[model samples]
Target: MNSPLSPIDFEDKRLKIKFKLEKRLQKELQALTKDPPTGVKVDAESIYRNLSEWIVDIDGAPESLYEGEKFKLMFKFGSRYPFDSPQVMFIGENIPLHPHVYSNGHICLSILTDDWSPALSVQSVCLSVVSMLSSCKEKKRPPDNSFYVKTCSKNPKKTRWWYHGK
Candidate 1:
């Protein structure tokens, strides 16, 4: 019969996994710092404070409705990052008034939920968010915003969103 790992073994395995996760995150951080997509900005402080969490700011595209406005995006990564998508949401006092964004900052982007791919990077996600805003025909919150914000789980990843015509 197979035996379970002892306490020491389990701890060692955890540390090893953590190390690997950090390594990957570090690589991403370097790349992001060196070259971030247009309109997306992140600080060394936020990314360094916790490798598992990052706060990125994006400016509304010049010709977009949200032009001259700024938005904060929060990304929280778990140990299985890269293998699993990070939890990303708009945060701060001003959440963009977008059709796909809830008042509470929950986003209904497909890649953040069911369509996630390990190949996607933090930079790419930020770029996607920028694109989402740039493509907006009108500035409005999601139709179900009120109900979803009041009843939804604090962790957006828990929600099963139906992404329609993004």
Candidate 2:
């Protein structure tokens, strides 16, 4: 016979998971601080205020179509964290004018969806977003951006999007 989990045991398990998540988030912060990817800037205040949410500022590559532009990315990590991808989106007034980005800040990136992996870190995500912007040859929005933005879920991660690149 098997016994049900006691309240004490359940609470202890919950705390252990919480501790692990906090430690993991802190480790990532330290790594980002020690050696951040090019063009990636984390809002230190956000990290201190709440480990669950982060605000990152990224600059457009000098020779890209978005040159001289700065954009903000907000990442919201749930309890699952590394086991699950963060809810990442472009935020603030300067959202990028790219086909993969909705005006409302929702992004259609594979790694944030079907391709997410526990091995991926915050730095890698920043680098990926930068690389995507740097490779854009045209300045345009997706044809369905208007409809999608209106109908999309409040949580961008829940939306189904297509990926055109590897």
- RMSD of every candidate to native, in Å, equals 1.5, 1.2
Q: Report the number of the highest-lDDT candidate.
A: 1
With a 3 Å backbone cut-off (N, CA, C), the pairs that clash in candidate 1 are: none
Tens digit per residue, CA lDDT, model 1, 21-94: 89888999889888887888889776787899899989998998989999999999988988899999999999
Q: What overall lDDT, based on C-alpha atoms, would model 2 receive against the true structure? A: 0.89
Model 2 TM-score relative to the real fold:
0.95
The runs of at least 3 residues in candidate 1 whose Cα sits more than 4 Å from the true structure, single-residue gaps closed, are 1-6
Report clash pairs, candidate 2. Answer: none
Estimate, for each residue in 50-116, the C-alpha lDDT of model 2 and write its tens digit: 9999988999988888888999999999999899999999999999999888899988889998999
Residue 31's lDDT in candidate 2: 89
TM-score for all models, in order of appearance: 0.93, 0.95
